[model samples]
Target: MALRHFFLILLVVSIWAFNNIAIKWGLLDLPPLMLTTLRFVVVALILVPFTRVNLHQLRYLAVLAFTFGFMHFSLMFISLNNTDAGTAAVIVQLGTPIAMLLAMVILKEKLRLVQLLGIAISLSGVVVLSGSPTIPNWWVLVLMLLSAFGWAISNMIVKKSPPISPLTMTGWLSFLAIPIVGCASWLTESDQITLLVNASWRGWFAILFSAIGSSIVAYSLWYSLLKHYNVNLIMPYSLLTPVLAVIMGVLVLGDSMNGFKVTGSLLVILGTAIAVINLRNLRMHAKLARFRYAGRSKGH
Candidate 1:
């Protein structure tokens, strides 16, 4: 990669990793479901007007939004509410391998063994991160793993489905998320508005960054990169999430990191680096498919 592209990857990955910290902190003040719902609503409102989509687009948006937006995140926040923040950060990285597996089955993409190893390595980090001298409940482990798969499946859906404008995809999916999560929130969470009103400005800032910066700006940039670059090259850098999460936790959240976190984080980072990176050719092949799809549409 060129020096500039390297930094672009760095910048985007930073945003994503930091978003985990943001979500964790936001949860301090808001219910997980309500906060997620609010974030997507903001993203949806901001992006919806920029692109024009017909009814056909609306249907596609609904599916994507439900799976990626509502279903995936609903599970995630529920899991987050139950698990430790540092541990949750590591667990979601499990999405890397899950995406690779799903991509092979659904998208018919080949997965290199190196990538498989990366997944295992990163996953070991989860094991290390989750259990202490005291083992956490197995239920928590299962829920966190489910959350990881949620994100991975969502990534696959985005990769496999017919291409749309990134903004259109982002906007509609987010907008659609509001009703499902909102109803869930309304039914389960009494005093929703009170929580919104009483939240500290810091919480509000976290919410805004997560809703707008991470979901809209960061995800938009990510989709653009995926549209233009090789995902394998990009996916490894996702390992950075746990790293950044630790930094943010210690620095901003005043969370402590123990020796296990250090060792596991190292293993995860090393595993991801070994498994997935240096895939310029892979990117070319993937985008060629996108180009072909675009061409077929024009001919029709």
Candidate 2:
């Protein structure tokens, strides 16, 4: 990528990193599931009128809704509600490595030696940080792991499925998720909507930002980069999310920092960098492609 595009990718990473902070702030006064419901509701309301889904591809979309929408957001929301956002962010960083393992086992993608080391590093970080008493009874830990799995599965489905604008995907998933999660909230909790009505303004503000900024705008930018940039270049930048999340949690959300969190955070960043940069050759090709695209546009 050109320096400009690289900087743009960095900007996108920063936005995503802030997403953890944003979501944590939103959950302050809002109930976990209920806040999630509102976030998706806004996303659906905004996106429904604009994008139409391909009915033929409903099967793939259904899978996306189940994994990405219902499971991922529900679990993450519940997890963040119970713990510090920084810790949740660090733990949720497991999704990338877990996805790699799934891709290797089921998709038969072979891992290079360095990639294997990266996996080991990430898993070690997970083991080091997971020794909290809160994890045993903490709904957040289990919920976050489920969210990560949902994300990984959805990623696999998205890889083979016919291309849809991420906007349409997010919208459909958000709309579809409403009833699924609403039913879940109803059955699991006594009444979540009541919590919505009773939530503070700060909570509502957080919900709106999570909907518009994190889910809608951040996702839109990310998929746009996927169109223009290679995954090798883009994926590494995503590691910034949890790092930013931890910083925001401490500086913004008042979560205290400790030695283990700092160490785990470093390991996660280092492992992600090792894995993503392992594709340096592909990244070169992607940069060349971006230049050709830009040159062609200028010629026109």
Candidate 3:
């Protein structure tokens, strides 16, 4: 990957790290499903006018809307409401391995041995983080895992679907998700009108930031990168998200942290660095070997 693209991924990670905080703040004023509904509303209103999709693309987008937009966001928000942002962040990292496995099975992408080791190390970190005392409920863990599964499935859909601009994908996705999540909110949540009317600026800002920063900007870039790179390569960068989220959760949300959390954070970071750096080294070595082989062929 180019340095610019790497930095872009880092940017997405940073946005998402703060996104955990945003959702936590938003939950102060709105129910989980209601907050998700409003988020898609904002996204649809802004991007739908600019989006264009065909029947074929729409088929993929509809599934993506449900899986990524509805299932992932709704479950994630609910889980975040139940658990600390840091714990939720760590748990969601399970999506990394899930996506990698799906890429191998669905997209037929291969992973290096080192990559596998890195994934294992990262998962062990997640395991350690899962034991954090901050996680208040076990049911939230299950919800988060399901949410991560939904996310992994959505990634496969994005990779398999025909080429589409990131903007179109994000727009149609948000548009399609509105009714699904909206109905969910209607059925399970109450006081939507009252909440929206009385929501603080922080709550509203959370909605706007989640809609524009996390959805429009971060996801669009993420989709573009997915189109260009293998899932195994792209997914590891997300491990860094939990580390940032944990730190912010401690500072901003007053979430607890301990030696175990610190160890897990370091392990996650180490695993991610190993995956990225080793993959780059492998590519460079392959290029050098190819150049040498070409020189020998020309001489012969």
Report the Cα RMSD per candidate.
7.5, 3.8, 5.1
Q: Residue-wise lDDT of candidate 3 within 216-286, one digit each (tens)?
A: 88988888889887765677677678888988898998988787777776776676556445567567756
List of clashing residue pairs for candidate 1: none
User: Whose lDDT is greatest here?
Assistant: 3
lDDT scores in order: 0.74, 0.77, 0.83
Which 10 consecutive residues of model 1 have the lowest summed lDDT?
127-136
Report the alpha-carbon TM-score of model 2 versus the true structure: 0.88
Clashes of each: 0, 1, 0
RMSD of 3: 5.1
Task: Give the per-residue lDDT digits (tens) of candidate 1, residues 51-141.
Answer: 7777866777777777777667776776666655566676666666677778888888887877778768877876776654222577767
Question: In candidate 2, what are the lDDT values of residues 1-300, reduced to their tens digit?
Answer: 668877777777677767777777767666677777788899999998898988867778877877888888888888877777777777777778878888998899998889878878876776656665434454556787788888888888888889887888889888888887777777776556666677777788777878888778777777887888666657777887788778777787788776666776678667756765757677578788899999999999
Better of 2 and 3 by TM-score: 2
* TM-scores for the candidates: 0.81, 0.88, 0.82
Candidate 3, superposed: residue stretches over 4 Å from native: 1-11, 220-238, 266-300
Instruction: Compute the lDDT of residue 24 as modeled in candidate 2.
Output: 74
Best by TM-score: 2
